[model samples]
Target chain A: MAQEKTYIEDIERTLYDIKNVDKSKYKSQSGLTEDIIRDISARKNDPEWMLEFRLKSLEVYNQLSLPNWGPDLSELNMDEIVTYVQPDAKMTGSWDEVPEDIKDTFDRLGIPEAEQTSLAGVGAQYDSEVVYHSIQEDLVKQGVIYTDMETALHEHEEIVRDHFMKLVPPKDHKFAALHGAVWSGGSFVYVPEGVHVEIPLQSYFRLNAAGAGQFEHTLIIVEKNASLHFIEGCSAPKYNVTNLHAGCVELFVNDGARLRYSTIENWSRNMMNLNTKRAVVGKDGVIEWVSGSFGSHVSMLYPCSVLKGENAKCEFTGVTFASKGQNLDTGASVIHCAPHTSANISTRTISKAGGKATYRSAVKVTKNAPYAKCSVNCESLMLDDISRSDTLPTMDIEGDEADIGHEATIGRISDEAIFYLMSRGISEDEARSMIVRGFVEPIAKELPLEYAVEMNNLVNIELEGTMG
Target chain B: MNKEIFSEIPMRTWNWLGVNEATVDKDLLVESQKLDIDIEADHHEKMVVEYRKESYGIVNISIGENASLKLTQLQLMPEERNHANEVNIVLEKKARLQLVAVETGAKSFASKVNIILKGDKSQADVSVLYFGDGDRSLDMNYVLDFQGRKTVGNLEVYGGLMGESQKIFRGTLDFKQGSKQAKGYEKENVVVLSKGVRNRSVPIMLSGEDDVVGNHAVSSGKINEDKLHYLMSRGLSPAEARKLVLEAAFNPVLELIEDEVLRQEIDSYIKERLENE
Candidate 1:
């Protein structure tokens, strides 16, 4: 079964994996404790309740059991996991103030340049701190609150306290408890009632520290009749030692509001990224999720939605890339709690190498939701025979009037299409890449131009690995 | 070899497949008998499933002198499935058997399914729907043999899988030789509402004899994004819209189950599950 190895699997990208986990100042001691939570809180200058909340969450984190199904998390030892790592820098709204090393990292990622022209706002988090954040002054003057989560917690304490971790609380799952206990830098945005943000606001997270975890928290609230589009980007320099990203993103779309949240995570393979995100849509409100999971050794991310009011709806568009050494179990969940509520989830996955990409999804129509309807269509692309893709979907229809349809197909790029292209003189690799880009292009096309370009570039990079 | 040397084998021999002895449960098998479409004494030249009308004891075997039997109901069933009170019959030429099946259930237990189309020129039109909280595996396999020309068979199954129970559905339309001018169609749809549940749909088609037509198709997933976006953009959250689409998705399968009493029973079971879920 042995053949030639791929380029990305070789040592070419070792620079990204190079790591030095300091044993001194920032290393977390063994096990989770109130003192550890307190020390981290003191370091971050958390208010009284945030500190108390972290300790309360630590209590819950220690008590809850690991998930019974999905990919195994037995390898993730809390004692071995350093939940927090403060990069060597302070928060800076200006690019000049960010430490040279951190700035160079983001520069290589091209975040500052992407923010300069395309995005309306951008927040950059390095390791456990949001080292840089900025937004259009027009947006600032318009009362659209977009800032680093830490500053938001202190300046707009009311908003932070009211909606923090509400959609997915500490007890929702084991990692969520861990996130609530020791969460750090992320983004916070509030789109006011009847307002519309013309451009997408984006946040990029970089896990620059080795043997440490990045626990950022993102909180977004779109008030009644408001509309907003937010994008989140996550990537990390590679580290031989395993790092962890247990970030949490909670969104609340109030009555008549519209919110679309998009995220692209390109972490390194030595990372166990167990992120949790969820949203709640109010009466006549809507929420959309566009997710891309390209890297991470093992990732369990399923963004959920709850239609809590009559006529509420949700749409989840996601694409996952499980290349070598990645077990990405990603999908979505929805609960129709009110009559006539509805949801639709369309997802695509690409599995290469020996990676495993499982589309695990569920939609439940409560008996009280008399007229609920849901339709799911997911497709998977297995680049090679060794890679695996499994589609496990479930629907609980308590309402006779409900409609549910699910269809998924798993195959490689059609040989016919590839041959047809190659016959015209296009190289096989480029032809395959073109087909794959097309396969994932639908989800990419929905993102802002810069993000779409980034997604295509990532897909191209993965395609290069396929050939090498 | 196209030889018919094995007709003497006891009907009981088929039971050797189970862990239990072939004859230990003898009550379900009545007096050994022979049935024939072309007079068993003459048709016995080929490996045959012989039957006698009087063999069912005083059970009264009047399938109507005019009753016509369909021939597609004599094939193999997959392994490891649930069943209760099933009957097998080798039909005489031109006997009829009307078919109706309804599936419904409570938490963890899915609705029961029934299949009975074991005759020549007999039509088995069935519609089954399952709505419940728990996992119920449905493995329904049936075949019909055609002794006369222009025999037809049809089967439709619709069900919902909730909670953690896994559902694997297998439906096949097999057409045999000399059953020329015979045709069959089968379709199965399953809804998986929870990550804990498992759903598998295998729609199979095999034609051993020519001059017969058969086809099968399956569609499974969650909801559609266009539908979700349309609803969400209209001020409805994605979850509410999903419920709407799910109801619309399974409506066709539910509408085919006739029998108001049985339909309502299945409908209520489905509704009850939704409420509890």
Candidate 2:
């Protein structure tokens, strides 16, 4: 009898691991201070009211305390981290007009190709500022405004001022205040009334600087009877030192409108990702979230949705994979505040190689939300004994007419299933990988074609060398 | 006048979804009991313990090898009185123990039960039923620790809350390292029958062995409308239909009392409570 061979191919991260030389034309000093915030505001040419808002947010950030739950953040020091980094390039509306090195980076990341093929618009941000932004002529003709946040603030001041940071206020948490204090480049989108954009708009964020923090604020609004789909993706190169990403996303779906938001975050192992996102739906409106978390040293992300009007609906589908040296705490939150509202949340997590994954969530049905319906399902799979998985869910229902259900399960892969698959002429490694792929198929099927393929490949790469 | 030394002592202090801290009144009398029995082969005994006043009591029991014990506890305190009760039990090899507890009336009630399976092949089963109404408060905690190989433990609780009443239930199943092939399970079901009632349930499972199984589940909601409608269509009044539903929900625990008269008394008490509501 021959022993089974263990295929130990390292998961290839070359596409995201490509780092450029440190050619920042402007860089803020290490540490967070009032002076640093003022300097960032000055560099971005913020208006007087915006500067005041930033100063007030800094005060709030100073008064706030770190969270006591989830992963430890004592390893992150604000004194050693630079709050802002600007690459040696200006914002451009055309890819060909972008700087050579930054354009090459996005080219290698396939951002420009994706823009040409599948996207209705594209915004690429390198480090702290968006370098290239473009939208199709038809979308512009249809009264859709998709551009960088800075441009939107200057051109469409009223709308930008009305919706910025309204959903996720600075007082929401510590990281939210930090984001408000020193936020940088992100995308801003608006669709007019009764206009339905058939294609999806994308924003790609690449943090190329080490020991620096990226705070991007994204605001999207779909007006009454309108519909749109937005996609966001982020990645960073590996470094010995730690990096921070505390971005915020606020979405508004008006009466009878619909919006779908999809995100794929794969930060390097040395990054701490503490992002916040929320959406508020009006009467007869709908909002959907599709999320995938694959990399990060520590992450505490739970996107929230508030159904604020009658007949509003929300759906959330998410998946997280934690390998070695990772603690990913991810889930979703929903609040039903109106009559006849409904929400559904489904999540799956995979942990291996001494990693830890915790699924924490909260669902609240207020007294006014009569006839509200909510269901939450969470499942975690631990591939080895060394790994750990936990689920903690809370439900508070005050309406007698509300219907709520929650279910959670944690376990390891079944040996009997593996044996059965092996007996049917499938290799052990292939069988195990197939099981994992099947575990996340429900979430993967909700993704776009390119992302679904990427998720499948990621599962295969994570299960490469576990056969014994 | 009885001379009493006073000290503020907090009760029900632990981790995981915590309940409100309470202090024991120093002026109340404390009563305790200890029982150690070693029964012979084929020996079986049934016992009933009742608490009816403002008092504190602790009972300890040990079952001998190859013996069995069945215990029913009743907390039937007066409407103006409060009571605190604790029970600890241990089982020997091939021994079995079954416990059924019912809490009906009290201003404030607190109870804790701990069971340990110390010998190989030991087994324990526990069921609890509680009803709260009219500003009453209930706190209950149950822990099962498995120390012997091939040991088994199961716990189930059913509760109903109405009016302005409140209740908290904490159930934990712990499987130690040496408890190979052990199995533990816990389930809790709670129904809130009216507005302003609060019900909290925390079910925990802690395992240190690889070959053991541990599971817990909790379901809290109102009675199904379809079930109620089915009974109402069968010529029963609305109140009668509700009483029948409550009976069916608690029949599993009532059937385990083993005393027919006591079971009937509880059934009548439940009917009376429902009629008042």
Candidate 3:
């Protein structure tokens, strides 16, 4: 008897790799300078305070130094990156009004179809400006304001002023300062008090120009006794030159409110992703984060949550895959500042073909946070010997009344499990794929059905040709 | 009059995990020893080493092929002085080594241990127990390098902290290339008993061989509340319940000590420290 031959196929990313020609009506000159900042502000017609705010942020960006930890970002030169690029169209409420080229890009990515069937509202940003925006009439009648950040800045000035860049100040980090200095277009969602948005709102960002940077600032505020869910999707076409993403997300959950923020980022291989996201929860409020990172040449992202009120809670569920020619350093952070606060962090990572994946986290329980509890669990799988996976977790508890636990494990797939499956009339390659699917089942279950299927397909593509 | 200056400089300088370097007094008196011998089949060796003064010492030992050695080390310097120690060990083909270390008293203590498996089928096991209280600080760095085929190494550390004490632990397992069929495992558990006490632990595994396996796990937190409540309900006071918890945590490392007298001394020292707290 002879054994059957098997072949593994690589994952096809045709849907996301389709690039649109550069059709920008305006693009800022390459490099960071006072002139470029002034030009961006002037073009956007910023308010007096906003102009000053951008200048202050640029000052901070110049004064602050790059981080001494995590993956090195020396290859990312600001001198070669164009800070902002405006497409050849203005904002529109109807999809038919959008330019054909811009509409084709979103259509290929299935944004309009998703909005029509699932999302409550959709804001599509092409390059550095929102090209199209729409919301369900019922949601708008219920006083739920969902629009582009630029419009909200002028219409709802007071609310946007109070919450803009407040949670994650420019001085938080060097990239944060850079984001504040050059941020262009993102989504602004405000759920009214006691209103429940049954469907999730989504914002899609498409970086079309090469050698350019995308700096979008997303702000979401759920008022007292209200609940909302927001999803973010971002991707770019592969290019020889470097592209940068330095976005910021600020979420505010009022008393007894809840917010679930989910993201699926699939940047091109020539991208350097340095994003920041933070949230502050009020009394008895809850915040949940679901994230998936599948692209980028180098990435350093850590979303944080501050449990500021009594009985506040947070839960973070994430998964990251670092394939060939990629290095991703991502995780979560939680600060328990009040009594009875609790946090749970669970993450999984996969590395193969010389890629490196690191999970770094910090959980701090202050002295005043009596009876605070935290638990962190991280698991990593290395498909080949040449790959690397690391877990670095820190717990700083100031009192003896707190309870904290951390557990991490790193290894490869077991041969016995593969053999067991193979004996049941399954091919060896299929068995390996099944095992990998099982490994990420916990994270896939947390996603929506369509997204879960997409994640599984990604796993199948990554596992192809991995077995000898 | 002439003035003499003394500086606390760590012999090794590098970042551990994410923390900075830990400094130690460099002016202490030095003592060193080296041991190399071969043992025949069905033979064994045992030795006990102790440090009692403000001093620095280095001890190197190599076990012969098919031989075994059981070593015990104790650190009991004065409460006001700082001390540093280093140990290196090698195991030959078919050789085995077992080590137990007990750390009790020192204002500031630093120690480094390195073990190498140089021959085929070598094995090593290590156990450590320590207590930190008052203003005392303890730092430990342990590395296990596997260079032989089919080698195995295992390490476990247990300790407790109270008062304003601090401790940092760095453990590494390195499997050299060509050392096929090798395995390494390490675990560390620490219990915090008071506020303002800091505990930092970093466990690393560096593997260069495809057929080798390495793993490490660490956990630091307060004692279990349900266990404490159960003990208190069974006719024990709060202090007694705390003592029982600490005892249970350190019992795994203590039971491995071969010397009864030394174990008794360590137990009494821990009991006195807990009583004062």
- TM-score, every prediction: 0.67, 0.86, 0.90
Q: Over the stretch A1-468, how does candidate 3's per-residue lDDT look in tens digits?
A: 332212222234677778888989999999988899999999999998888889899999999888867887999999999999999999999999999988999999889999989999999999999999999999999999989989999999899999999999999889999999999999999999999999999999999899999999999999998999898999999899999999999999988999999988889889999999999999999999998988888988888999998999999999988878888888998999999999999999887767788787778778778788888888787666566676656566666677777767666676788789988998877787787788888888888655787797766632334333
Q: Kindly list the per-residue Cα lDDT of model 1 for residues A92-207, writing each as its tens digit.
A: 88999987767777787778888877789889988788889889999888899998999999999988998898778898888899999999999999988899998889898888
Sorted on DockQ, best first, the list reads: 3, 2, 1
lDDT of 2 by residue, A1-468 (tens): 432222222235788889999899899998889999999999999988888888889889899888756678988898888889998888888887888888888888788988889999999999999888899999999999999998999999899889989998898888899999999999999999999999999999999999999998899999999999999999999999999999999999999999999999889999999999999999999999999998789998999999998999999999988778988888888988999999999999877766777676767777778788888887777655455565556565653566667666555555677889999999887787777778899999999777887786766633444443
Off by over 4 Å in 2: A1-11, A422-427, A461-468, B1-128, B135-155, B166-186, B198-218
What fraction of the reference interface contacts is present in each model, in order?
A: 0.02, 0.02, 0.26
At residue B212, what lDDT does model 2 achieve?
Answer: 59
Could you give candidate 3's per-residue lDDT for residues B1-277 as a string of tens digits? 2312222121121122233354564454344443444545445788788887736767788888888888888898888877777788888888888989888878988888888988889998999888999989888878888899999999889979898887877676776766667888888888889987766665655554545666677777788889999999999998899998999999998888778998888888888889898
The lDDT for every candidate, in the order shown, is 0.65, 0.81, 0.83
| C-alpha-based local distance difference test score of model 2 | 0.81
Candidate 1 lDDT over B1-277, as tens digits, reads 1311111111111111111111112331344332333323113221211111221211112243245332211111111222222224333445444444433421111121222233445455544454434554433333333334455666666656666655544444544444545666665666556545545443333333334444443544445568889999998766566666656765765555444664455455555556566
Candidate 2 residue-wise lDDT at A386: 57
Ranking by lDDT: 3, 2, 1
Q: What is model 1's C-alpha RMSD? A: 13.7
